[model samples]
Target: MSGNDIDVYLEPLVDELKQLWDGVETYDANKGTTFKMRAALIWTISDFPRLKNLSGWNTYSGLACPTSKRRCIGEDADQDDSYWKKRSVFFELPYWKDHMLRHNLDVMHIEQNICDNVVFTILNDSVKSKDNLKASKDLQSMGIRPELWPDEGGKYPSAIFTMSNPQKNVFLKTLQNVVFPDGYSSNITRCVDIRKRKLYGLKSHDCHILMEQLLPILVKNALPSPVSTVIANLSSFFRELCGKAVNPMQLGGLSNHVMQILSRVNDQPVDVTNNIGKTMFPEIGKASRAVSHFGLTLMERDQAHRHVLVNCEAVVPFIDTFRTETKRKLWHQTRSPSKIDRVVHAEFSRWFKRKVPMDSTLHSKEMKLLACGPMQARCFRAYNINGYKFRTITKEDGLKTQNSGVYVSSNTSYASMRDNRVAVGSVPYYGNIVDIIELNYSCHFTVVLFKCIWVDTTTSRGIKQYHLDLTSVNFTRPTHTGDREEDEPYILASKAHLVYYVRGEVDQEWSVAVHVKPRDLYDMGGENEKVEAAAFSPQPGLNMSAAGDISDLQLTREDDIEDPIEDVSDNIDDVA
Candidate 1:
């Protein structure tokens, strides 16, 4: 497919589609393709059919058979029809025998539908006259006049398209005045920055931002009490679920909104978002109905949860291979375009997961490792108790997390320990070198799942380290012993989310010394301190089995001879 919306290939899958549509018993002669049935795990996207059909440009629903008596969506509608197309390729799917929901509503699709309709209904003439009037009156209250807005040609383009030059100028000024949380600056969101681009082609994520941020600001105190409350309340749910942490609260809120949406269905166990939205605003309801038409409601579509989720593990390589072969550069036009091609996919678990096979000897796995780009010096200082080594991370989305070195949080005390945060260069904190495992999930910056080990100071031995792994995101550490001031080190252990080596090694059989024991001079009663084993250094013969792990710190002579400018490795194996 090209930008011109043409199927550039001379030979199409026309013959194969014909057999699938007809459901003819194939004696292997009719079907030319090697695989009679290739699986399609996810089937919903714009212009795409869950059954055998195309998506986007050049969509083909074999021989449209929508008689006046029956509307067969399989061959007619992109959405719901009066009748299900039994002749659809749904029966042709070989994997359907394994129990799978062949078609379903994508969350992205529903949310995008809600967003697009919400904007269009209020700003365009598509909605019922009453709803439009209410929306217009609300806008007028905010000093906005409907007459000043540009007249769109029926199709509700981006709301920006409705604005006159002066109106757009005002809108731009208001948008520029708004601010967002975190250190993020809204300066880049200015009209000047986007002058080269047309707002009409705004993607779903952009609409989401508009719904969450700018929409609320624009509609504040403008609409009728009911309209304002409903819109705001509804938007809150959408806002929370946007490309971020899906906490219990967010899930609950979504369920609650879904229930309210269900109320419009009147106790029937069918999706009625369209019913409710349309009743509220006919256009909004239509938009939602269109989405629901994608399949049966989210609930009814997959009753037994019968579906195969082809995760990033499978999808990423396929996508990467496509880009590599086609020599196509990745999407960089928008902030984070989540369209079919633009979205980045990565697994929560790494290739070298403790549970999963870590054997990177496989060519594909080796390529992923090689694609891990540059290594941090901290990796050279990498220590492994038995086979469990430190994690190596590269970028956060497309941006490099570490400019000079690994991502060390400057928001020290009150920092998020999970997302690229560690008290690097701080003493007693890995003694300036904590072991890390490179998290596998990084294609998109949805979540960073990696592990790091920090020396737990709770025990004087310092060997009792906190095991910060994937599971410990919200687990807050107990208040530090003497942390008083806000800026002081009130290290939340939950924030510490670090992990200690609990598995993969026998403590008695393999007790390797990593760093020197931090002994208190007062506890020793002024005894002269002996400095024999330096950090990452292995002792040759003497193994202090009687003492704890750190007490047996020893350096090999060769390692001892060289200045410890570089991180020493493997030499520590001579612990005894």
Candidate 2:
């Protein structure tokens, strides 16, 4: 037949075969069908030798050719059957490259299908080999069969066998050189080989076992470094198949797991400053900051300790003297600054007296005079007692007193007792009364006095007195005139006093006054109230009196005689 005639006749047949091949459904039972069909398609293209030489035609032929009738129809037609065979006769023999290329393509298709099925079985947990076999039977029942073989007869054409041999060699070589040479271990290499064998109809359970082992390796290897390095290397080696049909969801989950592992290993605070220029992923920065803060707080909590000490010196004095009843009363009462100030001053004064020294050079002459008992007494009478009495007299009485031998006026009576019984007409009985003068100074020195008073009233008649003596005290260190000078003047002064009649009041009323050096008498009402309260309700072991009262009374004639009658009347009236 003419080449054109043959082509014309074969064209419709080829078209029908192509349609059939395209329509042929894949079968699970017939594992080799797809590979066989692809092989037959390559054979059909080879039948048209002239077309095969065209540029880009080989690819087209493989894609478009019939899946059957690629060789001669007659069983015995060999040397003279076609021009292609004639050329093969002229050339030494048919080369394997052309045949192997098509065979490898077929083998590749089968291998891919096998891998897809295996992955499906692992991931889905529903599909199984038994299901695959059933599916393959269903396809066969529908008149669909593998296209490479013309019929179910045992013999395959010589050209087709030649094609398959080269195909096997090319496939195995490609696997060894391109896929396996990347240093995967022997076990993995054997696993992949089995997968290829399965594609060629060598069914074995080893492929499933290998796949099972491969899954953990993939998961382990794809994790973040450095622990996952081993697994990652293995996973990367399988990248060829992994790239083709990986489950994106599973991959994403794996990536997240890897990220979690990395986050734990590198538990440093994320540098938020680094994100200042990045506006696209604001959420990432925020999340990182939160994680960093959490880590920081956790670390701090993991490594913490504490120590405490309280100065109990001030409290030590009150420890034995404090009373539960007094504490309860004080707790119920609102706090007063006067009380607090007194306690604080007392504490500081005690500390200063015990720990600090005084300098005498800073004292004025007047202060020195006040420090001496006689001088202080003399000054006190001249300025306070005499002056107070003198001011109380009216102008008429004052003139009279200037002439009278005795200042018998009601207001001047108290003064007459202290000053020698001065007859106004005669020389002053106490002698020339030095000019009464008052001097004021800072906290250089002070004298506190106490006196008893008695009242003969029907409701009350008793003597009450309290004495608190404080001498010149310094709060800070004495200053020296020169750093090297051993004999530096004292920066403070000392004071003293006699209590003969420092305080006096008639009746049940008595009050003490604190006279600070250089002549000032501060009423003890405010200054001593806190001390009086504490002394009255002293704490446990320190309470001096069991009566619990700060003010006590005792009847005594000395108290009555010392109290001024008019003053006593006034005090009684005030107390009432």
Q: Write the per-residue lDDT of candidate 1 for residues 265-328, one digit (tens) a residue.
A: 2211212221222211111100101111112223211210111111222223334433332333
Put down candidate 2 lDDT per residue, 1-576, tens digits, no spaces: 343344445556556555554465545576655433321344423233333332112323212221212342222345223322222111111221244333222323333345445333322223333224444444446444333223344332221111133343443344334333334434333423423322322233333323323433433322234433533333333443335577765654444343333332322111121112332112110010111111112211111100000011222222222232234446656454334323332233233232212333222233223222111211121112211221111222535332101111111111111222322332111101211112122233222111101121111112222333311211122221122212111110011121211223352133232322222444457654565344443333442535566466654554555545464778888899
Report lDDT (Cα) of residue 539, candidate 1. Answer: 40
Whole-model lDDT, model 2: 0.28
What shift in Å separates residue 478 of candidate 1 from its native position after superposition?
Answer: 59
Q: Tell me, by lDDT, which candidate is best.
A: 1
Question: Taking the candidates one at a time, how many backbone clashes does each contain?
Answer: 23, 15
Best candidate according to TM-score:
1
lDDT of each: 0.34, 0.28
The count of backbone overlaps in candidate 1 is 23
